[model samples]
Target: MSKVPDRFLGYAFCVGDVLLELDMDFHIISADGAIKNTLGAVNREQSFLDLLTESGRGLIESSVKMLTGANRLGPFVISVGQEGLAKTEFAVFLAKLPTAEDRIYMVLSKPYRLGKSDSKNAPAQKTEDKKREFFNRLEGLFEGNPDAAENMLVTVLEASAGQQLDDEKRLDIERYLQSFSVGGAHATQIADDKFAVVHDKTTPKKEAADIAAELARATGVTLKGATIDAAEAKLSETDSMRALIFSLQSFASGNEGFAVDQIQKNCSTLIGETTERVRAFREVLDEGRFSLVFQPIVDLKKATTHHFEALTRFELPPIIKTQWEMIRFAEDIGLIDEFDYAVVNLAIAKIRKMLKKGGSPGIAVNLSGRSLSNQGFIFELMSLLRGNKDLKQYLSLEITESAKIHDLDLLSEILDEIRGIGFKVYLDDFGAGAAGFQYLKKLKVDALKIDGAYIKDALTSKEDRAFLRSMVTLCKDLEIVTVGEWVETQEHANLLREMGVDYGQGYFFGKPSPNFLVAPTAAAS
Candidate 1:
């Protein structure tokens, strides 16, 4: 690499700013006085990556890999200085050096200043902030005692269509929920498309049903709702809340078609198992007692592994025989996030090791709806992966059809943010849920996993086969890849390939294996 031009250096030095010269490997060969002062002797002859946080490193790494020209690296916010010391916020920027193809120049800007808030946007931001505050407050209302004398009934309402509810309709829904606010009953907008009503056991079932109907009638919007009464639930306060969350989610997704009594009964079953389930969940976490197996998704034409989907297996007591049962229990008890985090971390760690050894097929992990809804958890996850972002190219996140996305806009924003970080997002179980093709329109995703039910029954069921073929055609038109799930036979594989499906994942390819090296090479398990 050639040295930076004298004219550029002179200008950079004159600006009295932090500047450095870096090679393709990101090792700094020279540094200005500002950088020397800021870094205190470690400014030169080191990779600039050493100065960044994990997420910053990931962002820069990705940007650097994709560097085409004099690209700006970041206005990345960071707290600089040694740990436990007074730190300063700095925004770092990097540009590929024009003089040398394999070198770059960097500048650091300090002390972030806020720009003028747009008058129109200020109110929206405030409203969203207030909504978050209200959500937290409502969650706190049940914190003190699980066995309180009176039970609380939590009902959540969401629009059955559209990305958002208009201001007037939104207000009417909120007001209706509020009108039921007598004694312990209160309501709040929990999401852009979601509203919640919390009341004590005293509220009648008929009253709850009538209010839901009235809200839909008044707003002229079809709304879905789920009501869970804590008094009837056999769970602790925390577990009960999760039950309510999932119940609401189930309703919104059009998955739970049961009456209110059945819904409560189901939640009660989940609650009753909480203590034992929680103990088992924690034991798995504490002991690192879970294993992940990778199932290859084969490309029919190429006959090579495009990527592997990581499936987790827990070493639980004999009573818990199936993985799905354990996962459902984990979901019911609010431990799904922890469980997912553990599984993803393990999967990523294994992938990193595998990459170091050899090979580069991508891996996709299933992310629960609960995890997606929790913004804090999502950010932390991104931060964790930011340092090792090159792994992102081979990583994907699959959002299941059963995962209830109450706020389409929020989910879209989250998906876009994830994609921006260099990972692909696949819609799992597409065409099986109420949203169906509608989900694809609202949320732009890289691929869709055709609902397994359709694939499994397609051979004998003409309707299922037609749906599968149509979905494949639609996806091809949209330039989205389609993967046939539960493809357990040669006939299924051939049928999917004939329909132009890009990938196949099922027992037909190979069963999942903890050791990828030992995984089967045959097309059929």
Candidate 2:
């Protein structure tokens, strides 16, 4: 096996992870640790890109041009081919060795599956007998319904650069447009001085035109309305999706092309690609092909690791939007409950193994609010947690995802029961949602994982700093612990600790890793 050079030690990797030395053209020059077996039937002429799944190939292929000693790419998880374990997924990272002009180092860690697990799951069976229905209720425009408009009413309003944009004015227009009472009557600023309002199936052409004219007068902007009816235009499912993309680009770029069929790519790519990805996502959950990475949440006062939040990572096939998109899609398609159960199982299993090794480590797993809202799924999840009551002390739930949660009263009661059994609950993404304060008022959580947005801006903006101070005060008054996210620098850590944020989680603490990385304070001692 090829040895890792001394120059690349600044970047870290596990001992058994597959590493490779590749030339400027990305051809493998040297191999180390399972690369041969992982790729299977490897050749001297084959580039490192050949082994990667589609998404991985594109990311690495594009990102290497800017790679330097100070910068590294990824630790991003993606699918890769492996002998027997065809479904093998790896956490991939690459860095430039300072002196090696013709070479770069690539590291691939088996983050998801172990001996029995593979990166690619068995192909999902396509059966005509099984019937299914899916709802992608895209009422808004770019995802604007990314500008994914698929058969939605789009109104573009162009504003002159008048004395800068008034937030109050923008909010007024937004609120008015949203008052249409249609699902996803969403308004977005696609570009500077350009705003797009998207409405779903219920939006009437006459009503939209009236609103557009009224809004153009009110806001003093040029307003235009356009719609691409897939059925009306005799477009296919794929073409409709493409039309949305073209329309969004045209509007954003200050161009005008209401007729979409001419610009729409005449290929069956969109529908086929979406179908393939959805199938791949299903296979992932069905085959249990996901993995967990632990990022330390440190107790700021003692400067020790309070616990590690087990963030779920996916090893999906090429050409997907994002990991989160897949997860959100799972929730939409009624598959998140299964994925959530799998996560809880994995978290507890890892925690249990840690206890056996005489290491009293704690792991927090995220449970989506959408899943918790499901009565049956929550009951099943509660039963599983209750069954493994012993691991309750080691395993906690970081309740995130406030979007789908409707019955706060029931959710609060459910959380109280979970906490009643000794498991601490942390409200994830606190202060990021409209109902954050409402959730805080109702749900009895032990801690708050403060949203990264506020934490990121705290050092730069006084208003944000005031917000942090207020949040800390609120948590203090409630006697709840506070965890600040996106804490990347010593400055961030210092300020958060000074502000009395109880815990800190970010790259400053440590990044998510396969194994439990010790807290910085713990490491120093």
Which candidate comes out best when scored by lDDT?
A: 1
TM-score of 1: 0.56
Model 1 residue 517 distance off true place after TM-score fit, in angstroms:
5.5
Model 2, 390-460: lDDT tens digits are: 88778899887835377689999999999987889999988887546778889899999889899897888
Local accuracy of candidate 1 as per-residue lDDT tens digits, 434-482: 5566788888899999888998988899998888878988898899989
CA lDDT, candidate 2, residue 269 = 40
Superposition-based RMSD of candidate 1 using all C-alpha atoms, in angstroms: 18.9
Task: Itemize residue pairs with steric clashes in candidate 1.
Answer: 58-386
Those runs of model 2 whose alpha carbons end farther than 4 Å from true positions after fitting are 1-272, 402-404
- lDDT of all the models against the reference? 0.66, 0.65
RMSD in angstroms, all models? Answer: 18.9, 24.6
